[model samples]
Target: METAPVPAFSELISGTQRSAVHLEMRDVYDPGSRRFASWRSGHRENPANRDEWWNPFHSVIAEAVARGVQVRRARVVSEPVSDYVQFEYDVTFSNIAAGEQVRWLPRRRASDLALPGNDFWVFDGRLVRLSHFGGNGEFVQDEMTENPAVVKLCVEAFERVWERAVDHHDYRPA
Candidate 1:
């Protein structure tokens, strides 16, 4: 049976109220992305060049925070981080500037945590947008669920990681 299309992340966040938390468990992502390629070439995202790098994703977080929604992101990464993770770390200033409370957790620190296999975004402690990706780190499909049990699992796992993760400003690439 066919499934419904997943809503865009921007659309999901646009409808969020109260809070939105993201949990990323991947060490590498979007290896084929232009931004990733730029980073590999030693190009960095300059916060001053806002118009060049700012996108709807950043705008939505800023808007959510302006509306009193708490936006947070926790990333579980391996130590001696991958190039992609390093790239993400380098560019995270923009995420912070966009009003996201970003944190990074060393993978070793999450050993006792029960985290979902895939990355996800939990909205208002209710809906979850679970992200699936191909082995090569290409986008596959997103599954949106409002099941209370699943949402609870995600919320709990995210909180556990957030509690141990280092704040973006304090995290240095290892």
Candidate 2:
């Protein structure tokens, strides 16, 4: 993992050959974004309309999936979900359409498991791209690492959460 010139999310995922697993532990990330505002204002993106729902993020994921790279995302949220989490739930069809498997785990169910301090994506079980967020749920820069100890910790943590989480389609935020 190279941190000097931090690579984009697409670069990280493209470099992966086998699998990419992401563990998102935040209930509200970037809470003041326009996307969330639009959703709150009763503006929903129609999945059928690619022009309306497609974006760079989805494009990269779809490309990776076409190349046989398995992508999975697991989120840990509070029991009574935050507004942002509900918003995320409503927009997850795009992720599904892009070929990413998503799951959600309640914080209560994760009490016994050891988790990382920040969110991250472990690529091919070797490199880890850690997500950093401000105290106010604002977007922060990401850091990448290839330390064996750190990678192992993230991989294990992600697997633990993924195992306990419910599939996105079945998860009913509450």
Candidate 3:
């Protein structure tokens, strides 16, 4: 049997009424992405050239925030972060500039928290979209669910992380 297509993240974000929270638990992701490759080579995103690095994903987020939808992202990472995580930390200012509230939680601080196996987005506390990736940090597939129990789990996990995470502006990578 064929599996149903996963809904676009933008679509889900656009449909949100009040809030959209994203939880990223990986130290590395999407190594094939141009931005990641650029960071790997020592090129960093310049705030002055915002348009050069901005994309539709950012637009969706900006739009959501403009419409009174609170967009927050919490990342749980290991101390002495991986190169990719450091890259992500350096570039997160773009996300902040786009009106996203970002936080970082050290993995050690999350030892007692029960987090989902995959990174996910909980939109309006009603839908959950889990992101799957390959061992090499390649995109694999997305799994979306509206099951109340799963949504509740995601929401709770995100809240616990957010509560313990440090504000992006205050966090300094180890």
**Model 2, residue pairs in steric clash:** none
Q: For candidate 1, which ten residues in a row score worst on lDDT?
A: 1-10
Q: Report the number of the highest-TM-score candidate.
A: 2
Model 1 C-alpha lDDT per residue in residues 72-120, reported as the tens digit of each score: 9999999899998999998898899899999999999889899999999
Superposed Cα deviation of residue 62, candidate 1 (Å): 1.2
lDDT for each candidate structure? 0.90, 0.91, 0.90
Error of 2 at 88 (Å): 0.3
Q: Candidate 3: global Cα-lDDT?
A: 0.90
RMSD of 1: 1.8
lDDT of 2 by residue, 1-174 (tens): 446456988898888889999999988888788889999899988878888878899999999999999999999999799888999998999999999999999999999999999999999998888989999899788898988989999999999999999999899999
TM-score of each: 0.95, 0.96, 0.95
Give the C-alpha lDDT of model 2: 0.91
After superposition, which runs of candidate 3 have C-alpha atoms over 4 Å from their true positions?
Answer: 1-5
For every candidate, C-alpha RMSD to the true structure in Å: 1.8, 1.6, 2.0
Q: Model 3 compared with the native: what TM-score?
A: 0.95
Order by lDDT, highest first: 2, 3, 1
- Candidate 3 per-residue lDDT, tens place, 112-165, comes to 999899999988898788899998888899888888878889999999999999
